[model samples]
Structure formats: C-alpha cells, structure tokens
Target: MEVETNNNNSYLSVVRRSSRRTSFPTLQGLYVSLFEGEITSDGLDLSISNKNTGKEFNPKLLKITFFLSIFISTVLCLDHGFVSCNLEYIEKSFGVGYAQSSFIGSMVYMGFLIGCLLTGLFLPVLKSKVLLIGSLIFVVFSGIYSSKSLTLTEIYASRFFSGFFQAFSIVYLPLWVEKFSPQSSTTTWLAYQQLFSMVGVFFGYLLGGILTCFTAEDINIYYMSSSEKLSSLFISWRGPFIIQSALIIPIILILIFIPGEILDVGDQEQLSEIEYSKTTGLLVSGVDLRRSTNNNLLPDENNLNKRNSKLRRSSVLLIPSQSNNPNSSKSLEIREICSNPIFMFSTFAVCGVYCFTTCTLFWLNQYFVEVIKVDRITSVFSVACIYLSGPTLGVYIGGITGDLINDYHPNGFGFILTLCTIFSFIGFITSMVVAQTHPYISFFWGMIIILFFLTSTLPMSLIVIMKSVSSKTRQLASAIAQFSFNFVGFLLSPVIIGIIMDIIEYFPFGALKRRYNPIEVGIKIMLYISLPTFFFYSLATLCSYFNCLISPKITQKKIIIANQIDIPKQLFIK
Candidate 1:
C-alpha cells in the first residue's frame, strides 16, 4: 500500500497489493483531514469510513431570534422618543416651569444611565432573557403608574423608573443579539438592530402625536364649556402612557416565543465551531476536542518539572485570564479608557451636542406658539418633522456609513462624524442669521433645515463612540457618552438657557435688546452654544487619526490572530 501526506497535494490515492489481488482507494480533499487505520481497494467502488460528531447550523433559528430581540428592544426606544416629545404637555399638566418640566425627560435619562451601569456590571452573571424580561416588566408597571400620577414628584418617579427599565433594554438587548449572530455579520446585524430602533422612534413620535391630537379634539368635542374643555385637555397627556402600555403586551408575548437555548453565548460559540467541523466532514466535535485535552492527555513528566521554573520566570506575564477577575488587566484597560484624552474630549462633545439638541427641541414648540404666533398643531407638526427626519433616516445612514468606513479604512467613520458636526455648525449659524434678519416664514423654514442637519449628529455620535471603543467595553463607553452628554445638558440646559433668557429680558441692549423676543434669544443662544460642537468634532477627527496611528500594535495583534485562523476553505463548502 502507498500513502500520501502533503499539504500541497490535491488528492490522496492509495493502492494495496496482496498475494491474491490489488486494491485501490481515492480520497479527494483540501487542507488537513485526520484519519486512523489502513485502507485497501480492489479496482472497484471504494468505501471511505469516518465518524461524524458536531452541531448543525440552523439559519432559520438565528433569523427569528435576531428579529424578535430587535423588535422588543425597539419598543423601549419608541417610548423614549414619545416621552421626549410630550414633555410640554406633561409640564402643563403638572403646572411646572419649563426647567422643572424638563426634569421629567432628564430624569428618565438619569435612570437610563444608572441602569446601563448596573446592567454592564451584572450581565455576565445574569441570563440575558431574565434581564430583558425584568426590564420589560419594569416598563409595563412604570407606564401604568405614570398614567395614574397626579403630583409632579409622582410623575418624575414613574419617569425615572421608566428610564431605568429603558436603559436595561438598550444595553442588554444588543448584547443578546450579538451573542446569537455570526461574527462576520455582527456589524450588519447591529446596524439592522439600530435601523429598527429608528423605526421605533418614528412610530413612537407618530403614536405620541396621534394620542395628543385625538385627546385634544375629544376634549373639545365632549366638553361644551371652555373651562371644561381645558380641564379635559389637561388630562389628555395620560392617553399616550395608556396607549404605550397597551402596545407592550403583544411584545411581551412575542418575547416568550424566543427560544431560550439560543440566548446563551457560550453555547452558541461551541455550536458554531461544531457546525463548522461537521460541514467539513470532520469526525471530532469541538466540545470533544476541548475535553480530550483534559480527560486523556497526561502531562509530560519533564515538562511538568520545568513548569515551576517557567512559572517563576513568566510570573509577570502569567496572570489569570478569567473574564470575571476584578484585578485582571481589563481593570487596567478600564483605567486607560477612563484616562483616554479622546474619550474625555468626546464626552464633552457629547454633552454639548445633547444639551443643544435637547434644549432646541424642548423650546421649539413654545417658540413656535409664543413668538412665531403659529397654531399648536403647526408647531407640534413642525417640531415632529424636525426630529423625525434626522433620527429616522440619519441613524440608518450613519450606521451604514460607519460600517462601510470601518470595513474599508481605519478612522474613516470619524471623518464622517466630523463632517456631520461641521454640517450641524453650518446649520446652526444659518438658522441664527435667518432668525435675526428674515421673516417668520424664512426663520421657521431655515431653522427647520438647520435642525434636520443638527439632529443628524445624534446617530453619528452613537456610531462614533461605538467605533472608537472595543466591544467588551462598549456598554461603559455608551453609558459614559450618554451620561456625560445628557447629564451636562440636564444640569446646564435649564440654568444656562434660563440665564440667557433672563439676560435678554433684563439687559435688552443693542442687538441683544433688539432681539429681545424670548424665542429669538433662545435661538441665538442655541446658535452660539452649537459652535463648540464643530470644534469638538474637529478635535475628535484629529484624535481618532492619531489614536489609529499610535494603536498599530493592537491592530497588528488582531491581524495576526485573523491570519492564524485562515478559516479553512473546505469548512466553508457544503
């Protein structure tokens, strides 16, 4: 018998000669194929024997899980958009000033920040589904409680819990999605997940608008007296909470349908490896291979003696690699992340961006009503249009561009974000100029145009943060970005904007006095504050480029790992 064992050889053909007859067998293959025992052939049909042990790939199961997780998570995001839009109505209902009323929205974000921090710490210990279900339950109860709140404190408390639950949904849901998806498709799946989230935002706004409009009309239609109508309209704000609560029931039921087996990340990884092995006609299961080392292989006697000496010499680099180790290098990584100059700068940028965005949105409705003298319906519609255009289209566009840039070139995503920031500055400047010199129509239209581009940065910032940070640290990264951006805005918005308005009110000097209209003054302050966003983005772009150059060692390590796992061509075939 003749046997061939060479990497470059295309086929392995064996011929056996016995006293009675000659036998031949052919095995066509690529790459390595480990086999045991001898083969004999007699110029006839050859039978090749091999054991099969591995998991099967189920594409259908993957798709179903991805879709359901995204849908459920997006429901919470929708609620966020709805609550943000209804802040004005909420303020009027509770008889609070704009600053205090802004708390209703800001409190929710605060809760979200806390939830994200907690979830990130606890996720590895807790099952993903348990966290998701727990969050959903919190949301349902919060939504129901919010509808019944009579006092501002009670409302704020409900919103805080609602925000907390929403935060859990945001952080954990994507992690769950990433757990199930193939590595090659991780970015694509994440992008689609974000796309659905934007859709949820669109729907949330639509639902909030619909509820507010109908409730207002119903109040007018049912109550003949003006005072009675006003009283009835006051209660209309609760309608959205009720509707949103009702919408969540079906989502809960859908969550139940998702298979629990698919939710385990470790199990999925093992299964993926097993499936790859099986498809390539391998006889060894990945799990078995892992076990074989521990179960059957004995430590070399000489190697065992040398282990102590090696341990002493390599103790500096031999630290335990367990993911849960509190004292592990990951802690150092976290410290490094915290100390990162780019991260600090980006946090400030995020704060500035969110503050301006939130402040503008919060005040625009009132501005339309009081200064521009537009009807409530027109103001609401205009405000909705401004928000709706960016998040809906801009998020998807941003996510796609981010993925494309990351895939093709290092730091390209940062360039895209910088461009977005530049556009935001341009938009803000144009809006300010228009507000100063143009007619109400010109001002309104110009502001709308500017707001569209300004809001586009929301998604761009999200993508930028995701690109800059590693996957393991993304939760904290997102939390820091969201918290700093939002908290600064929350703290400064009411005070700074209030002070600006107060200045315009008390001073009334030269150009400032001439533009003493509260709405115009608000717009002017927004315009001035918005200039920093451009500066920050410019800084981010430069930082990202430098970080990329300085981080060559990390990139080189990843490339080395990638090359080592060349992903055998035979494994890819049927």
Candidate 2:
C-alpha cells in the first residue's frame, strides 16, 4: 500500500512540472511581444542589451543640434538673394546683354537641380557630414574664384559650382532636421527651418545692399586697354565674394559641432511604416461597432469559433502579404507623387508664385530708384526693409496661423492658401495703383504694406505644400519647389522682362527710348504681368480646395505601421 501511494505522488509532481513549463513559454512570448512594442518609442534603446548599457541622450542637446544644422544650411541660401541684388552691377562689369546676364543666375539653378538629383541618389551611401563639409569647401573655393573672374562665362561657372554645393547642404539640412525631430514635430521643425532660410535671405539682401553702398564709385579713369577695365571690375567684384567666403568659415565650424546620424532612405521608409501602422490602428479602432452588428447576426458558438480560426489564419497571411520591399515602396511613392493631380497642381502653383516673387524681389532695387525716385542709398534701404520685414514677419504669422488651423480643422491649409492668393492679388493691385497715383511717402508706405502681405504668402505656400505631401517626399518636394523658383528667376525672368523693356523702347507709339528709365519699364511690366498672375493664383486656390477634400482619403490608404524590430530587418538589414 505505501509503495503504491509514493508512485502516485511522483506521477502528480511530474504532471505539475509539465504544466509549469508550458505556462512559462507562453509568458515568455507575451513578454517578448510587449518588449518589442515598448522599445519602439525610444529609438536609441533599439537593442535590448544596450538599453541597460548606455547613458541617456538629453532631449535639449538633440534640439540644439537640429537648430544649428538648420542655421548653417540656411546661410547658403543667402547666395541667391545677394547675387540677385548685384545683377545690374555684374551686368555692367561683364558687358553682357540682359538675356546673357540671366544665365549668370540660371546656371546656378541648373546646378542646384543637378545637385539635388545627385544627393537624392547618393545620400544613402555618403554621410551627411561628409556631404556638407565637401559642399562648404566647394562654396568657399567658388567664392574665391568668382572674385578673380573677368569673363561672364567664368562668373557663371563660379556661381554654378557654388549653387551646386549649396544645394546639397540645403537639401540635407531639412532632411536631417526631419530625421532628428520627434514624429509629431515635423511641421514645426520645417517651419522653423524655413524661417531661418528667410532670415538668411533678409540678412543677405541687407548685407549685399550695405556692401554695394561702399562700391568704388565708377570713376571714368580711362586706361590704355580693355584689360584695365577688366582689372578694375575684378577688384570691385572681389569684395562681395570675399565677404561671402568669410561667412562660410563660421557656418562650417557650427556644422562640425552638431551630433546626429544622417538619414538613409531605408530608415525613413521604416519610420514611415511605423507611423502608418499607428494611424491604421487608430482608424481600425474607430469603426462603428453598431453598424457592424446590424450587418450580421450572431452565430452559434462552434461556427463563431470556426470563423475566428479562419480570421486568424487570414490575418497572418495578410500581414506578411502586405509587407512591401522598402525600395519598391519608395519607388511607388515617387510614382504616386508624379501621377497625383494634387502634386501636379501644387507644383504648378508653386512655380507661378516663385516666378512672380523672384522677379519682383530681383528688380525691387531698380524699381525704387527709377519709379519711386529714391536715391541709391534710400532705394537700397527700402529693398532691405522689404526683404527683412516681409519674410521675417510672414513666417512667424504663417506658422502660428497654420498651427492653429491644423488643430481646429482638417482643410485649414487650403483655406489659408486661398487667403494668401487673394492677399497677393490685392497687394499687387494696390502697389500698382499706389505707384501710379499716390504721394511719394504714401506710395512708399503702400508699397511696404503690399510687400508685407505679398511676402506673407510665401510661408503660407511653403506650409501648404509641406502639409499636402507625405513626409518621405517633403524634402524632395521642397527642393523641387525651390528649383522651380530658381529656374524661373534665373532663366526666364530676365529674358521675359528684357523683351518687354525692348518692346517698350521701340514701341510704335515712340513713347520710350534706350535712355528711358529701365526701372520705370520694370515697374510697369510688373503691374501688367500681375493681372494674369492674379488669375492663375485664384485658379490655384480652387485646386487647393479640391486637393484638401481628397487628401485625407489618399493619405489614409498609404500609411503603414510595424514594430521596431521588424523595422531594422525590413529597413536597415542588408
């Protein structure tokens, strides 16, 4: 009897041991699942082992690194603004026709587009720091070379190299900002980045204008040969480039101090997927349960069990089936943007705005001197006012307004953009009318008000574009938008405006001559062209409205989410 009892106890103990082992495996699986989800919030804690080993990165340090990167990148954008202001002087020195002079600006933009293409393709292989440092070196060298150049072609070549290098730095800066920012802060970071860019433009115009004030007066000291004129021109042009070249040293130093990893396309894709999943879960959770219940009656327990089994099997298959190759997904995104009507419309609208704005800004100093009857000093100061006040105030106001509208309504950007278009139209008309009729003081103030409103539209347009597209495409889109502006300003504006001036000069009415005020011709041309621009912008407003309506649905379909562990293998694993 005692032997039989002891055997029974051993059998029960063995059964209990088996049950505990089985439960342990289940609990271990649950812990692993929870760990994967939890670690996703902290990118630095990617490795489970590293979580306990490394010192925590302070958030403030990250923020500083991001802001400094933006500031450095933005400093290069000043090149365009400064060069644009100096075009007349440059033309005088090179003895180039207006059409040829336009190439000086256009070649830079051509280089910018090529640089963007190169960076987009090669950034994954090269580090951001290396690209930035290389770009800065190029800019510095280009500046020094430009100061020594006598020929139009030589200057163009220098500007092209400078622009090409600057483009890489500019494109990568925003990309890096996006990479380092918390997911929810993308727009905010973008806004601030753009703000710094505008600030750069403001300072560029101011400094360029100030430097021009001290330009060696063109004393008619005729020398024996053409070489003398060329030599003097070199000395005059050298100053601006020298100043610009000196500015790059501080920017390089600032960039060297920033700490962060360069973003690869694969990493961005993974992040995009993670964000998409979270959004997808929210959408799934929002389904109306009552409506679902009304559509189907309850089944018997066995049938329900069978249905659940089928659902589990289908979900398992679907999840893996839905998994996309990161490269393929990026390609699809690019294709979608190209095919998308909203993107097309937005691109067109941006192109138009850039063309008009750049023309206005580029010729503003000329307009002030000829039409407004301001002294060179006063005109330069006025140009400075427009550049500094308009963009600086505009960005601050636009950013605040965008944040408010985004918080309260889904279609806010559309409305804001429409408002901006309307403001631009009104401002353009007011400036034209004021120039024609108002007292000098009144006209000046009116022009200032008009410019402020017109400039305000710039940030609104930028924010609208940023909000309309996926984050993955935002940098590329911004680059394209900027490229359109540069292309129009450099290649199209000078030629088109020059043609208008030429026609006015030889008009059948015999109203103007070669000695007629070029500045007056410029202002009149601006007024006339603005009428058509106003109409185009109004059409853009309508397009933006339609885009806002469909954007949510389109965005919903493209979003995806996945665990961080899945992200590494899917995105970064070779």
Candidate 3:
C-alpha cells in the first residue's frame, strides 16, 4: 500500500495495489465505507488510483473525463432555461394564470437554495464525486416523474426536487474540476465549466423550442382546461424532462468508469519538501524559512540563537492546520473574510451581476414573445443565441484582460470591471428604450452586446475577492461568495419579476383595458421597467468595489510581495 517516488527524478513510481480490483469502487460502497467511520478529518480523499494503473490516469484521458463529467453533470442546469422558454405552454397546460405559475419557478429556486446549504454541510465529509453522482440519480428520477406529471402539485414537487439535486452539481463541479486540474490551468478549466453550463442553458432553450413545434395544432389548446390539455398526446411542456433524461443517462454511465482524481506528478518535490518541513518544525506550509539556511538569511547555522527574531515574525503566520481542530480555524477564517470590506463589496458586486443575468434568463423569452411581438421560434432562437455567444466569451475576455491589468496595477481589475458595468448599465437602458421600435435589433444589441459587457464583471470580481483573502481561507471564501450571489440571483429574481409582471397586468383599470389590452400593456411596461433595476444595482455595487479598492486602509502590498518572493504555488489560489 506504500506509494513510491523516485529520488532522482520528479516522476511518481507505480505500485500495483491489486489484481482482482478490475473496476473502480461503486458509489454506494464509497459512501458506505465513509459512513462506517473511515472518514478523514482532513477531508475527502478521492485520489485513490484508477483500479488498473496504480499510477494516475493518462493525462489525455484525465482531461477528456473531466470535461465530459462537467458536460454531463450540467445537464441539470438546463432546468431554468427550459422552464423559462416553455413557461407559457406549461401555464396553459396546467390551466394556471401568471401569478399561480410563478410558484413553479419559486419552487425550483427554493429547492436550489436548500440544496446548496445541505451540500455545503456535507462537502467537507463526503467525496464530491459521490454527491455529484447521487444528485444526478435523483435529478433523473425527478425529470422522469416531472414528464409524467398529472397535476400542478405534482409538477411543482418534481421541479423542486430537480432543482434541489441540481444544486449539488452546481456547487461541487467547479470544486471538483479545480481539484483535478493542474495549478497553472485551473482558471482555464473553471472558465470552461462556466462555458459548458451556458452551453447546457442553450440546449435547454433549443430543446424547449424544438419540442414546442410538436404541439397539436389542430386543437386550440390555449383555450382548453388543464384536463383537456393533459389528454393530448403532444403536450410540449413534458418534452424537456424526457429529453434531458435521455441526454444525462449515458454521461453518468461513462463517468462511473472514469477515475475520481488526477495525480499531479510534477508537484512531487514540493510535496516531499512540505513533509520534511512538517517533521522538522522549521517551516510552516506558506513560510519560506526552509530556504533561509541556504541563503544569507541564516549564515551562522551552528549559532541558531543569532537568527533574527524579526525574520521569524515576518515569514510565518503559524495558523492551525486542517488535521488539528478544523472547525475553530474555519470559523475564524470565515469571520475574517466576512468582515473584510473588500470581500463584502466584491461579493455584492458579483451578486448583483448574477442577479441581472438570472433576470434575463427567466424573463427575456417571455418579454420577446409578449411585448416585442416576436414569433415563438425566433424568440427562443434569439435567447439561445445570446447565451451561446455572450457570457462565455465575456468571461474569457474579462479574465485575460483582468490578468494583464492586475499584473501591472494591483486594483486595475476592479477599475476595468467598474467601467464595464457602467457601459452595461447604459446598454440596458438603451436596449429597453429601443426594444419597442426595433425589437429584432434590440435582441442583438440588448441581449448579446450588453451581456458581453456585464458578464465580464463576474470573473473580474471573483479574481479580486480571491486575491483579497488569505490562501488558507480561499476555498471557503470562494464557496461563501458563490452562495451569496446564487441566493440573490437564483432564489429571488424570477419570482419577483413574475410578481411585478402580474401586478402591472392585473391592475384594475377599465379605461386602460379598453384603450390598450391590459395584459399587453402590463407586459410591455414590466419589460421596460423591471429588468433594468438589477443592472443599475449591479453598477452601484461595482462602484462600491472600486471605492473599497482605493480606500486608505485596504492594501495588497504584502500579498504582492509574498507572490514576488517565490512562495510555492500551493499557497495561492487563482
């Protein structure tokens, strides 16, 4: 069971662990073993080698497997986009009004919020892979059950469970990808994770659009009751669940055969050095005291008392390791991050940005169909195209540009993000102004270009927050930051937008209804008024981020110096 590494070279040597272990451990056995008290306090150790190799999987296989897993798991991400695109059809099929149908969206978000909290609780104990696999199973079951739903209550329950389970995939997939990826390529891999999730969203839009074409045209189902719609064979509202299930099953099968982690043989020297330092007690993980003996810092090694006390104070922070009482240290770190103004401003900025994105995702299709007077097919295609082309491209552009700027100026990333948000704010206003007269043009200008600008702020703000915190707290900080944004964006935006739309549409005004249809007027007014609030709020948050960056008390000089002094890569999070 001993792991072997060559002293002469950096490569890890293979040690065949077994011959009868023909396949990787089953998900059930993995969880059962942990539940029976085999768990490690340091956290889940899923790096157990592929059953056959004893060494890490081939690099190419590892990359393929990781990307494929992300793609498959994100099939659950299709829920919102699919629902948004087909909301009208679903409402009609269920014989529900706008206010009543909003509950379905609310249920999904509620489940998602609850799921995230529960997943976060178990994240440090269970293998993320097991949570991911278990969540996918429940998601598939929910999707199938949803497809066969007979009543509004049944569909709500199905959607809630689906959202609940999908939360595991959402919160864990990025962390899992980061764990397996090499340090150098971590950002790129995370970016791809975001990209693939958007790709899933596009598929959701496309799926709903395509299936909606199969609606039985002979019968006017819009006027029919819920029971009448249910009797029909071609109810398009159920199609997304069935199609998503078909797409996800094969991916889950493939992932079970793939290994859980990729061993980074390149970090062998660093790993050995840390182990040696731990035993000698001369160096902490982030401190460079181990190198002091080789350099002029400790010239008189025999007379250890001659060593400078100031040097020790400057180099090491002496924090408790995870093997010790992790709870105390984690609590302390959480308090530290939460109290820091930089973390707060940047987190809120990201939250606002995400809330804006979610609003568009849930309402843009309805806006186009109802207010802009666009055809259903064109509206769906336009929304899909915007997602397909906007957010991913925006993230790449922002990430690369922000990296270059941060290299030259410590706060340059925030500066640039602020400017982008201002531009996005302007774009949002202009789009709403022009949407009525030039609807198609607004789709291109408002949805695509504005998103391109606004979405870039996401990665920029994330990097700022990541850099602001200490390395020991990076993982927790990142989790908490994401949870904050998702809570506002996913759990709140849609229902609020729907409520506003209903309030405007259903207001008592006999004269106004006679002059212009109340429903159309309400939707048009809601489209014009409701969506801009998030973008404007996001702009305000970015301003706060910029202010925090330039404040007198805030400084990154020490962190930058640490980076410049060749601190090991393990001490930094991108």
The parts of candidate 3 lying over 4 Å away from their true place are 1-57, 216-235, 263-330, 402-439, 509-574
Q: Rate the local accuracy (lDDT) of all candidates.
A: 0.53, 0.53, 0.55
Q: Report model 3's TM-score to 2 decimal places.
A: 0.69
Q: Candidate 1 lDDT, tens digit per residue, 494-520?
A: 446755665665563555657567556
- Residue 132's lDDT in candidate 3: 66
Model 2 worst lDDT run, 10 consecutive residues:
11-20
What is the C-alpha lDDT profile of model 3 across 140-238, one tens digit per residue? Answer: 999888877777889889988987887777766655554455534544556667667777878887887787766743434446577755644334757
Q: Rank the candidates by TM-score, best first.
A: 2, 3, 1
Question: Candidate 2 at 473: error in angstroms?
Answer: 3.7
Better by lDDT, candidate 3 or 1:
3
Off by over 4 Å in 2: 1-57, 182-188, 217-235, 262-266, 270-332, 410-412, 435-439, 489-491, 502-517, 528-537, 544-574
Off by over 4 Å in 1: 1-57, 78-88, 177-203, 213-235, 264-331, 410-441, 444-448, 451-461, 489-515, 547-574
* Per-model TM-score on C-alpha atoms: 0.66, 0.69, 0.69
| Each model's Cα RMSD | 14.3, 13.5, 12.3
For candidate 2, write residues 304-326 as lDDT tens digits: 34433432221010012123456
